[model samples]
Target: MRPIGLLTAAALSFLTSVALAAEGKEGMPQLDFKNVLLKSQIVWLVIIFVVLYILLSRWALPKVGAVLEKRAATIAGDLDAARQAKGAADAAVAELTAKTREAHAGAQAEIAGAVDAAKAAAAAQTATLTARLDAQLAEAEGRINAARAAAMGALRQVASDTAGVVVSRLTGVAANAAAVDAAVGSALSARGLG
Candidate 1:
């Protein structure tokens, strides 16, 4: 099949020349119905018009329509792709948000657990230290009591020796040991020291 565009271009050029010739011939010949060539010109006009219309409708117009349809389909495909991409991006963003929240929660849980463990360890250490200090205090108190007992025993011996010397010097005779010890014991008991 011949290209309709080329045929149409040729037809337009021929029609322009015919129109110019008709003007040169003093008037529009195609409109003059009384002329011998008027019938032939009208028949030729009808034939050209029908042929042009058929060529445009069957070949040229269908090709243009197909091109338009193809362009529309391409645009639709691009739009669909863009929408799908947007959906995927949205899903990815939501997933990332969820994961971030989960991770944050997990970290918080870990921190709480660590704090609890640290608190437990501190309590255990405190208990152990308190027990150790209490034991040391008891041992120190026992030592102090023992020292006090030893000092008191030594004080009694010293007092007895001093009493003997004082008695000999005052009476000019040796004091009896049993009588001196009895006097010291009575003196200590009266003073609430025995």
Candidate 2:
């Protein structure tokens, strides 16, 4: 048999022997221990059991429930705080990214503006330089025209004097030298200088 069964049989045998010894002689009454216990008072047992149930339900059970509720609330509050912190971190990251983008845009705008200003300044400088050069060229041309005109006038005066001398000598004509010189001087003076 199983160990539990063997142990139970031994316990039962010992109880039987004790019960038989506790009895009177064989002719006297054989007292039954089971029947004596059953006939004993039962009112006190019911009262004790009821009192223990009332105390556990009213005080002990409520206290245990309150402790469990407090633990649950603490865990939920911690989870909520974690979630809020995560949201705040995400918002901060987003803000930083936006600021970086804005800074890049601003830098690009500044670079473009500087380039435009440089181009405009270069164009303006070129215009100014070209105007100055054009004015110089025009002034130089005017001076050359004046000098050429003066030179041509002097050449004409010399040619006239030479022709007059040749004709007077060939024809044996006595031309007035003073009149010829005066005419040549007048021709030279008409151009702007004597």
The digit string of per-residue lDDT tens for model 1 on 158-184 reads 888899999999998999999998898
Tell me each candidate's TM-score.
Answer: 0.47, 0.49
Q: What clash count does candidate 2 reach?
A: 0
Each candidate: what lDDT?
A: 0.89, 0.82
| lDDT (tens digit, per residue) of candidate 2 on 21-58 | 67842221334435555345356667888998999999
Of the candidates shown, which would achieve the greatest TM-score relative to the real structure?
Answer: 2
What candidate 2 gets wrong by more than 4 Å, as runs, is 1-57, 145-194
Deviation from truth (RMSD, Å), model 2: 9.4
Cα displacement (Å) at residue 67, model 1: 1.7
